[model samples]
Target: MTELNFPALGRQPTGCPPARGVLVCWLAADGSQVHVGDRLAEVRVADDRFGRRIGWVSALATGTLWHQVRAGEVLTAGAVVGLID
Candidate 1:
């Protein structure tokens, strides 16, 4: 079992494609140990053009980063940001 984090809400960097209204940022460097309730990523939410924070990304279970992800990237449910080793 692996865990993924939600991207934090904030300004979108210039040149980077706007996250489909959502983004995910990993806490660990691609591959790392993850524990329950561990902060994995930050999720950004927007309300009528005004960006707001939804919440912090947490790990569902202990696991490892299976795939590498970059900042300011949109993430969908079960996107497989990483896999537990």
Candidate 2:
């Protein structure tokens, strides 16, 4: 079985409308293969005042994108945006 992990340990965002923005700019474009430690998505969050917040998520293991994500989207903590097979 493949194991998934956080690319970097940081404050995980919670709640609704003011979700953290997710961008897949630093990794392969959607539909490309990747490996563990490879940049998956770069997240820029907003502080209570909606300022700049930062974090990144990388491939936890080598796999294909069972699904794809886009840039400038919002995500909640522990949301599985992609599936690796």
Candidate 3:
């Protein structure tokens, strides 16, 4: 398993949830082959009263996209939401 992990959300100067967000959408389809630097999915984090924070998870290595996360699913920091190959 490639094991795609969640990336850190914003600077988050304070040591808060490293990657707290909801899996909004998937740019690449499950089981689809992806290249390096390809956008995997979009995550939305309800940071504060200002607005929701958005982040993108990208593929680190060229391989097949095997998503371990689902749309609208809320996840925490450092969570392994997917895998490659």
Candidate 4:
């Protein structure tokens, strides 16, 4: 099985802190088949200057999706969001 992790969004401009975000929603359903680059979920990131911004999380492999995180959950860089098997 392959893990689907929340991707790092780089550093903040002011203090160079890592970006933190929340899981907005899942675009792909659990147990659904997905391919590489498929949109898996939506995330809302807290930006210092830009406020909150929405982002899409994509699948890294082709397999059945199993969610490890739920909507509205807090997220950090490299957090395990799901699994593909």
Candidate 5:
């Protein structure tokens, strides 16, 4: 299995994630099929100096999307968002 981490949306050049974010939506639903590097979900963020206000959760391995965090869920740094198998 491969673990999907939440995007470093609020990570700045200073090496800090200043703001928390929410999981806005999933591009691919749980139990759905995905390939390597597929978009699994979108995260609505609160800053841009670090990255896009909307960050993406990407699949790292080809497998079935499973145990994805729900939309509107608050995420912090290093949060494991999804798993593929």
Candidate 6:
């Protein structure tokens, strides 16, 4: 099985702190088949400098998707949002 991790999108070269985000929604339903580069979920990231922004989480592997986190769940970088099997 492969894990789908929330990316560290808010990291900056200026040494800005890592930001947390909420799992806005999943683009594909649970158990749906996915391929690499497919947009899997939308996230609402709250960065201190950038304020709020939308970010996309993509599938890292091609397989059946299983969501481990629900919508509105707080997420950090490297958090496992789902599994591919």
What are the candidates' C-alpha RMSDs? Answer: 7.1, 4.3, 2.0, 1.9, 2.6, 1.9
Ranking by lDDT: 6, 4, 3, 5, 1, 2
Error of 4 at 59 (Å): 0.8
What ranking emerges by TM-score with the best candidate at the front?
Answer: 6, 4, 3, 5, 2, 1
lDDT of 1 by residue, 1-85 (tens): 6445444345566685544435445566666777877767666666446645565667677766555566676664345455566
Predicted candidate 5 versus true structure: per-residue lDDT over 19-70, tens digit per residue: 6788888889788999997878888777755454877888899988896578
TM-score of 3: 0.83
**What are the models' TM-scores?**
0.57, 0.61, 0.83, 0.86, 0.80, 0.88
Which of 5 and 6 is ahead in lDDT? Answer: 6
Task: List lDDT for all candidates, in order.
Answer: 0.58, 0.57, 0.81, 0.87, 0.79, 0.88
Number of the candidate with higher TM-score, 1 or 4? 4
Q: Give the higher-TM-score candidate: 1 or 6.
A: 6
Error of 1 at 9 (Å): 10
For residue 67, model 6's alpha carbon misses the true position, in angstroms, by 0.3
State residue 76's C-alpha deviation in candidate 3, in Å.
0.4
Better of 3 and 4 by lDDT: 4
Tens-digit lDDT track of model 4 for 18-66: 6789998999999999999999999888877778788888988999999
- Which regions of candidate 5 are displaced past 4 Å? 13-18, 48-52
Over the full model, what C-alpha lDDT does candidate 3 score relative to the true structure? 0.81
lDDT value, residue 45 of candidate 1: 64
For this target, which candidate reaches the highest TM-score against the unseen true structure?
A: 6
Q: In candidate 5, which residue pairs get closer than 3 Å at backbone N, Cα or C atoms, i.e. clash?
A: none
1-85, model 3: which lDDT tens digit per residue? 5778776665665755464778899999998999988989998877665468888888988988898879888888678888888
